[model samples]
Target chain A: MKVRRSERLVDMTQYLLEHPHTLIPLPFFAKRYNSAKSSISEDLGIIKRTFSLRNRGILETIPGAAGGVRFIPEISETQARVIVNELCERLSEKNRLLPGGYVYLSDLLGEPELLRKVGQIIAAKYKDQKIDAVMTVATKGVPIAQAVSYQLNVPFVIVRRDSKITEGSTVSVNYVSGSSQRIEKMELSKRSLKKGSRVLVVDDFMKGGGTVNGMKGLIEEFEAELVGITVFAESNFSGCRVIDEYHSLLCVEEVDVQTKTISVIPGTYFNK
Target chain B: MKVRRSERLVDMTQYLLEHPHTLIPLPFFAKRYNSAKSSISEDLGIIKRTFSLRNRGILETIPGAAGGVRFIPEISETQARVIVNELCERLSEKNRLLPGGYVYLSDLLGEPELLRKVGQIIAAKYKDQKIDAVMTVATKGVPIAQAVSYQLNVPFVIVRRDSKITEGSTVSVNYVSGSSQRIEKMELSKRSLKKGSRVLVVDDFMKGGGTVNGMKGLIEEFEAELVGITVFAESNFSGCRVIDEYHSLLCVEEVDVQTKTISVIPGTYFNK
Candidate 1:
């Protein structure tokens, strides 16, 4: 059956959004819509124009027999700053303060809309880099890694503190805990990360960068390259972080355990 | 700026996909596109018809003064079966089988595209239910929960085996480990879940049903209702499952340790 242009546009939009960072040849869409190449090309032009006009994302068209269109989702700097500013307010809630200067982030991270936007911000920043996989420690960092991986259209690896039976053969690394100043172990499935792949590390929270450092070491053990590391929030309470090169979406400038006050600002990524 | 019908359809499709299970007032779209209601409705008509025809999902338009449109992401029965069947093949790979009847699943779960489809399958099963949140026990379950929550447009709560300080005040519960017959503890932040919430539980794997049973009990302690429980795969090696009523997308029929053969079949959901 012949497909209408409107129908073709909607279906094509959905497909591009679903398969981000993936190239789909013109013939593929033409056959799916049972339309001519010229018609499909026309539909793509409209989509490309609209996507750019709305700042939705980038739609790159590669010309020639082996060429196709690819979608690279992006969060504009203006939009990212807005999201980070809003997070600062949410982090300032008095009830989020914990006993030992820890700020509760589970509630904020649990919000789906917030997580989606946060994922967009992080993925947008690294969209141009050659990232093979997103990596994070088990438990808190899993969700963030999954979110970023979704946008990048890449697989994610979870480095666990405790090795489970289901992981099969594994690679383990021991590092100094940045917070406790004690030795800790982290491991990943041998089958999870490819040798010499580029990996981006992400986490929900960072303090003294112990966990991030641990992941950096584990990456080396896998023979993988550490492309970058970013966190949702980082605390300066420890004053001495083992890893100096990192990006954070939100920064905890101070947490006054004495008065139950927490001051948070935009993280190391943005200009203050 | 005046938005054309074509642009409106593309933007609307992207917005609805990102915000599934959400109601968007027609006027909201009209204002966003700076178009008339009649034009907006016509654009929606194109999207709705295309979505249903392509099996993308259901586009529900509620008419009246307080009415709007809602997008419910779904996977058709045939599509779900295909995914489950493909999973059977992946699970049956000889290398996935490990000592002690365990099957390595991290590689499969790490795939973003596969995880998105799995999330859609699980979300479609519980799309109509009043799911306040998607809950899963940490480490393996976090990605699954996040994926399902993304489709359902609901927040997800992580129940950790060991509580982290960032969780703040938490509610802890002890249950007998289904596989080892040993008692283990689980904890969720007190603020992570609201009382009287209708929650859906999901996980990466199930054996002996101990973890699911523990979560079931934990749900009751929170005064929340267990709307449903689903697992990516369930192993029958134990020959005894603590939870009787649960759904599995793939089942490990048998694993021959001596011969190094693994037999997997479509999970309990299919009639095979």
Candidate 2:
């Protein structure tokens, strides 16, 4: 009942992916496979090399004093596409999803592992863009901002729906959200980002894409370029100019929170 | 004038520390310092070795395309103690910090760099504890939780002030915060923690240490053992029940937030 090395690598990657910010000792894997520590190390090396070649992750070894190895999730292009498409498909069920034409993303946002991977995929896409910072509106956007900030090594800045005096001076902007019904206001701190800098925007979900456009206006106020935009889930059918360059993990068509039926489709960047 | 290599190394470490997840190209550093790329590489090597020896961080280099270097904040034991003492001193201003006898932590928590360092130190202390997870109560504690989780590579479980049906099911506990006169209820997910596992508890501020005690009770409910306890700031004058194992960066004395007068004392760990 021994697993092959390839099987082990895939299993290990999946396990580590599920357990972000965790280290698994070599002995643990060795015991699981009934193999020597040295053999496990060799297998890990192969996996590490594969990940490195694909620019997807890091396999870190802590030496001595009860040290082990950790895998930090950094996905490759192919992996990102695969994950996005998989999510899109799950979200594309029309009969289940399309209710009043608004996509319900509350469930996906609550999922820890999915959120973590979605963040990694977005960050990797903009890694080389010399982004000065990552920005998103408060509450729902905070998690996505956190993920992108972690991967990009840039500071995560929060834009507030309502301005607070404690944040010091601020710049404000207005844009219409969902279905282009009406414009909404959003504001950000003036000192949060530098002028002529590149900024990456991320959000948990987009309906009207209005908030995304408002964020863009706020960035423009600071003379910063909106280098990239990403959302965990977007409704492509919304027909809004919320994002210029964006990637979505899941695209929703119809969501009925009442009936609990939702339809999902593979995102545009899926499996690319 | 040209900067010395040591200054560059220190600055490099600080810059890398501030940006935990981003990679810096060799050219970026070389351009900043007006040095050759090869020279910059040599400087990075020296810093990397020093970082490893000091147990301050992990400096990783990525090869080609989307490659550069990243500093993962992993402090050494001595560094951990030093940080705890610093926090203790900062919180020591007894007369100035007292706004109804509550030490003002608004300034400390809001500083990005300080919050980041505090998180790294806490994570460093339990670097090998096999922390099935990091735990903290909500609101002010979220930042600390985020920091520790980033360093430890574990998902931080947030104990909420109140439970929502949206959270599924929860286990509730009663504990008195230092600032509050009455005992308040806190909750955690019924499925959040595993049974008989080891957990590290962290909080932003500790006075009566009642919240920590409450957390201990919650852990017991899951049959988990308390591995350790850590606080960013500790008030020695509070005369609270001392945790079996704890660390603080700064000590606060009677603080007067209105008068803006505060007393600070470095902790013993600083000299370690």
Candidate 3:
């Protein structure tokens, strides 16, 4: 496939991010891009060093039979700025978002490159904190929480709205979400934070901050302290009752789910 | 802190797996274990080479203020087997686990060390599948799914039971869970999966296998192919009809929630 220098860097970064379990043979990227293996190596060298110099990532190369390179999910502010700017530009087409006051984020969430950048940005903020764990309610929260937990080197715990037989016994809690609706929820027994454990809570979106606040309450019940709260995006329309130590990757101001017109500004967290 | 050799390996592995965002300063690990920095570096060197030799992971070292060694989550069958065996043995306590019709995996899922290993194993299986994303239904599936997604460096997609304002518009699905008395509800975004995308599905426990099959249907609806399926533990009691191409880390026979007794054998996939 035809590619640009920037696109190649993105593709290479994306590949390493997706294959954290195995190294990519150096020749592999060369063959994929129809470039000499040596040239590919040089390109990777630049990208790797650039990432390191930026304090945004670590490019690791494994030697011998099973050796290749892997990309650690670390992104610097410069990288984040480039990505968020591109995202804002792409989603700027307000007319395409459609009625129902929501812009479709599935495509972006599915992008490996975008996810890596977002994960790195969120993880950077809480790097030194004694975060015992990372928490998010189930489903959409899994991806964001996974990214953060991966960066933080901690197990991620999920809180559920209802109990499933799979979770075994659960600890339940009730809280009012950003929608101002009180909801009852339960966390898997093994998923509870230890007494006085420090946790960082993350999610995909914050419409009312209710879900995140509820998670905070549940963490408190386990004698854990909330170290930080982060979201992929926060709805500007919602009243922000979320804790002071919070971050967002994006902010949405005008969401016309019915009209399909959504205005999204880059999240303030990116500037940090 | 008192540390076991095996536990040291486990902890190092867990530490590396959890912190894919940055390198671990050699001095930091040295202080944590009250060992010499040189000794810590030596241990890390062994780990780095072992992972590289096995085609499982990469050890990246940073040279300065922004530098440290980081372990990207990846392990080969041999390494995975070692960790998995330890996990089964540690959790095999019959008294600690309940015996009934289900297996109590809460404790295992809750512990950071165990969770990290579980994530590594699952991510190892799909190391080269070129998965665009990882998906799991709400509640119990979040942790496992998050774990796998983190190592794979892919975005995690959570399927919710009910729609929330934060998610905007969603596409709903109906499926029968293996143990549930009635058909259950699940949902994802209409825009989550792109056409012809490859998805890896994971869950915490498998009893009836209804939810997984339901996810398969959703994948098909999105015109995406199900690349693989994995679970932490699968129950032998439920004559469940799980799709053919799935794997489980452990096999559980019975769990008594009240009596606190459980029977868990290693999963058949462990042999493979």
Highest DockQ, which number?
1
Q: Which portions of model 1 miss their true places by more than 4 Å?
A: none
Error of 3 at A202 (Å): 2.0
**Residue pairs in clash, model 1:** none
Best by lDDT: 1
TM-score winner, 1 or 3: 1
TM-score, predicted candidate 1 vs. hidden true structure:
0.98
- What DockQ, on C-alphas, does every prediction get? 0.87, 0.03, 0.12
> Which candidate model has the greater TM-score, 2 or 3?
3
In terms of DockQ, which candidate is stronger, 1 or 2? 1
Please give the range of 10 consecutive residues that has the lowest summed lDDT in model 3 chain A: A2-11
Q: For residues B110-227, could you state the per-residue lDDT of candidate 3 as single tens digits?
A: 5545565687788777765678789887666766766676577676777877776546567777887767647888888766667888999998877778888889888887889889
What DockQ does model 3 achieve? 0.12
Encode model 2's per-residue lDDT on B205-263: one tens digit a residue.
Answer: 67777788788889988888888887776666555453545766566655665667666
lDDT of 1 by residue, B21-77 (tens): 998999999899888998988988999999999888999999998888999998889
